[model samples]
Target chain A: MSRYLAAVVLLAGLAHPAVGAAQAAQNATLRRAQQAYDNLEYRQVLTLARAALRERLTGAERARAYELLGFTYGAMDSILKAVDAFKQVVLLDPERQLDPNRVSPKAYSAFDVALRQVLLVRQLRVDSVSFVGGQGAVPVRFTVTQPARVVARAIGSGATVVIDSGAWNGQVNLRWPARLPGGDPVPAGTYTLVVDARLGQNTFSASQPIRVSHGRVDTLPSVTSLPGYQFLPETEIPPQSWRPVGLAFLYTGGALVGTLGLESSSLGSSSKRELGLVGGAALVTGFVMMLRKPAARPAQANILYNHLLRDQIARRNQDIAKENVARRQQVQVTVAPVSPVTPK
Target chain B: MTRAALGPLLLALALRPAAGQLVAVGPQFVLADYREVASGLRYRGNGFGGALWARRNRFSVEAAVVRLSFDPVAGSAADSGFTATQVDAWVAYDVAAYASIEVGVLHRSVDPEFDAQSVGALRVGARSFYQIGPGATVVFRANYLAAPKFSGGGHAAVSLDLGLGLDVRLAGRLHGTATYAFNRMNRRTNPGGTGEIDAPIQETVARLGLALGF
Candidate 1:
C-alpha cells in the first residue's frame, strides 16, 4: 500500500505541471498577436488578439492584446476601430507606450487622435486689451485639436461688433480691431468679448467682459464763483454801441450850450464869463477822459472761483473712485484656460 | 456791430445745433498787469468779464472781453484803464493722446487805443494735457503770435503767450476753468513813424470762469 501511495503522489505532481502548461499555452495567444502585428499580418493579429481577449488574461496580458489590436486596426486604415481598441489599452494599463522604433508615425498619430477624442481638452485665452492710436483692439489665443473656424464678437450696449472670423489650425493668435465693421469707435459702455471655434460638427465658446471708457459728459451746475461787481471794468467788458468818450462829448457840448445861453441878453458878462470858463473846463475834462482808458478793480473774484474749482476737482476725484469700483464689478474677465466641453 | 464782430457770433449760432458741438458761456474774473516801455508805466488791475467758447471735434473758437481799471501810476497824469476784447479760432491735430499741434487766427482790441496797440495775429502753438484725477485735467499751452502790420501804423510785432490752466467737472456738461497766462509783446520800431516810440510790453492775465457744454 505504501508503494502505491508514493507512485500516486508523483502522478499528482505531474498533473500539476500539466495544468501549468495549459495556462501558459492559453497566455501565449497575446504574445502570438504581438508577433503577428510585427510581421505585418494585421488580420492575423486581430484574430489572435480577439481570441486572447475572450479568455481570462492577466491585466498586463490584456493590455498587450489591446495594444496589438489597436496597431492592427490602424495598419488596416480602420481609424475609428483602432481608436476604440487603443482606448481599451489605456483603460487596462494607462502607462503603456508603443515603441517608436516599431510603431509607424501614422499609427502614432492615429493613437494621438484617439486619445484626444476620448479626453477632449481645449482652452481659449484673452491675451490682452489695448489701443493703437485711437483705435482699440483685443488679442486672443487658443489651441486647436485640428483645423477649425474661429469667430470673435464684441458685444456692447447698443451694437454688436464682429472682431474676427477666419479658418485656423494649430495654435492661433489673433488681433481683433475693437471697432465696428464700418470702422467707427464703439460707443462707450461695458462690452462682452466672445470667441467661438467650430471644428467639424463641434462648437466651443467662451466670453469675458471689458469696459470701454470714452470721456463722460456731465450736466451739473458750475462750481466757479461769480464775481461781486456792480459793473465790469471798461477793460474787461465786451464792445457796446455806446462808449464813454461819446458820453463825454455830449457832456462837453451841453456845457458849451449853457455858456452860449448865458452869453445871451438875460445873463451878465461876469456870469457869461464864468459859464464860458465852466464850458472850457468841461471840454478839457471830456477830452482827457477820451484819451485815457478806464482801469479795472483787483481780481478777488478769480481767486474765489479758482478755490471753488479746486474743491470741485477733489470731489470729482472721489466720484471717479466710486465709479472705478463699479466698473470693476461690471468687468468680469477670465483669462484662465478652460477644459473642453464634450461634443453632443 | 461790424461784420468782423458779427461773424463769430453767427458761426457759434450755426454750430450750436450741430451734433458733437460744445458751447460754453459764463462770467469770468480777470486780473491783469501790464508794463509799457515807452511810457515807463506799470498798469495793474482786476476786473470781471464774459467768455464764450465753441468746440467741434478738432476745431474750436473762443472769445473773451474784459474791463480793467488801473491804479494811479506816476507817469500818467490821469487814471488809465481799458476794455479789452479777444477772439481766436483754431484747429488742432493730435500727435498723441495728451499732445496736439495747433494753428489759428487771433483778433484783439483795446478800447481808447492804449499806445495805439494792434492785436491781429497768426497763431501757432502746442498744447498738452494730463489727467491728474477723474474729471480734472492740467493743461499747458504755448503760442507764437506774429502780427503783420495789422495796425494802421504799419508796424509789425511778435508776441508769445504762455498759459497754464485747469479744467474741473462740476456737473453734467458743466466745468470750471481757471487759467493763468503770461504775454510778452515785442514791437518793431519803424524808423521815422510817430507810433514807433512805444516799447515792448509784458502782461500777465489770470482768469476763472464756468464752462457749460451744449
Candidate 2:
C-alpha cells in the first residue's frame, strides 16, 4: 500500500505540468517572501526566497526575476539571498561588471546595514510595523489576497500590536470601519501591523494595512483611493529558436532563385552565367513572397483577457504568429544575427 | 421595442445624470464647391447637424437643411456667382436604454457610419448634448456619402455632401458642425465644349462655420 501510495502521488504530480508546476510553485513561494519583506519580516523573506531558487529557469529571465526577488529579501533585512539574486543578474549579463547600473560598493554596504538590523530586531523582540505612524484611535482595513483571519489588540501604552508568527514571514492586518463611537475606543498612538499564522499554512492574514496619521484625510467626504496595481504574469520564452528558422528560409529562397536564374540541365559556361542571373531573380522573388506572407504571432498570448486592449484588435493579422507556434512547435534558426545595438 | 435593440440604449440613458435638459440653437453653415471648364454651372445642397433637449436630458431634437445654387457662367455675367440654401431637423426622446421612441423632421437615416446596419449602438452624441449619462460616447464620426441628389431629362446629374455634428454633453456646453457639398453634370461625352445649347445647371459650393457655447 505504501509503495502504491508513493507511485500514485508521483504519477499525480507528473500527470500535471510537473516542471512548470514546480516552477510556478517556486514563483508563488518567492512572491510570498516578497510579501513578507513588504510586511518587514526580513528573516522569513530570506529563507523563503532562497528555497525558491532551487527550481530551474530557462535563461536570463530567471536570473533577472530572481534578482528582484533578492532585493525584496534584502530590503526586509535578509542579506544572503539579496547577494545571491543580484549576483545571478550580473552573471546573466557579464557586461554588468562594466555597466554603471550595477552598483557594487553601495549595494554591499546597504545589505550589511540591513543584515545588522535583522539581528537588532531579533534581539529587541518587539513586533513593529516599520513605515507607518500617526495620531488618534485609527480604524484599519485589510485587502488580503489570501484566506486567513487576523486579530489585533493594543500592546504598549501608546497603542502598539505585538505580532506572533509560527512562520516568521507572514502578512496580516487588523481591520474595522472608520469609527467606533464608545469611550473605550482605540486611542491615539503609534501601532504595528503584525501577522500570526502557522508555518506551512500558506494562507495570508492582515492585522492592519495602513497606519492612521490624522483624522483629517480619513474624515474627508470626497477622498477616493487609487486602484491597486499588480504586475502581469511572466511568460516563458524559448531560447535560440529563431536562428534555425531563418536558415531554413534562406536555403529555401536560394533554391528558388537558382531555379529562376539557370537551366539546371546545362553544364556549359553560358549555363553557369545564366545560373547566377536566374538565382538572383529567384532570391528576389522568394524575398517578396516572404514579405507577402503574414507575419508570425507572438508565442505568448500577451492577452490580458479582462483588459480592454486585449479585446480591442483593430487588425486581424495580429493572431497569426501565435497560431503558427501552436500548429508547429518546430525548431528555430536565425540566418542573420541582428542585434538591437545601432552605431551612432 | 425589440429585445435586441431596446436593451442597450435604455441601459445607456439610465446611467446618465438625471438633469433638467436645456434648449439649443445655432446657424447652419453650408459649404459646397465644384470646379469645371464647362461654362453654364449649377450646384445644390442642404444639410445641418444640431440638437436640443428638455429637462432630465431624456428628450432631444436634431435638425438639418436642404440647399441648391446655380449660375450661367458662360452666358450672363450677372448670373455667374448665383447661390441658394435649405435646412431640415430631426429629434428623439428616451424610451428605454434598449429603445428610444425617437422621431425627427430630418433625423439620422444612416445610423452606423461604420457598420451601416448598426445595432443598438448605445452611444452618446457630441459635447453639445446633455452629458448626464456616462454612456458609450461616439462623438467623432466620419460619414462618407457619394450618390446622385437631383437628376432628370437625358443628361444625368449627381450630388454629394459630408457633414459633421456634435451631440449635447453632460454639462450642456457647446456644439459644433461643418458641412461640405458637391454636384456634377454629365452630358454624354461632348468632346468639343461647344455642344451644350441647353441651360440646365450643375455647380458646387461649400460653407465652413462652428457653433459656440455662451
Question: Would you list the C-alpha lDDT of every candidate in the order shown?
Answer: 0.57, 0.34
Native contacts conserved, per model: 0.00, 0.00
Q: How much does candidate 2 score in TM-score?
A: 0.21
| Model 2 residue A176 distance off true place after TM-score fit, in angstroms | 35
CA-only RMSD, every prediction = 26.3, 34.8
Candidate 1: CAPRI quality band:
incorrect
Once fitted onto the true fold, the runs of candidate 2 whose alpha carbons sit more than 4 angstroms away are A1-344, B1-25, B31-37, B40-63, B66-83, B87-152, B155-172, B185-203, B210-214
Chain B, candidate 2: TM-score:
0.35
- Per-residue lDDT of candidate 1, residues A253-272 (tens digit): 44334333322121112122
Model 1 preserves the real interface contacts to a fraction of 0.00
Instruction: Please give, for residues A114-133, the per-residue lDDT of candidate 2 as tens digits.
Output: 33222111111122222212
The lowest-lDDT stretch of 10 consecutive residues in candidate 2 chain A is A119-128
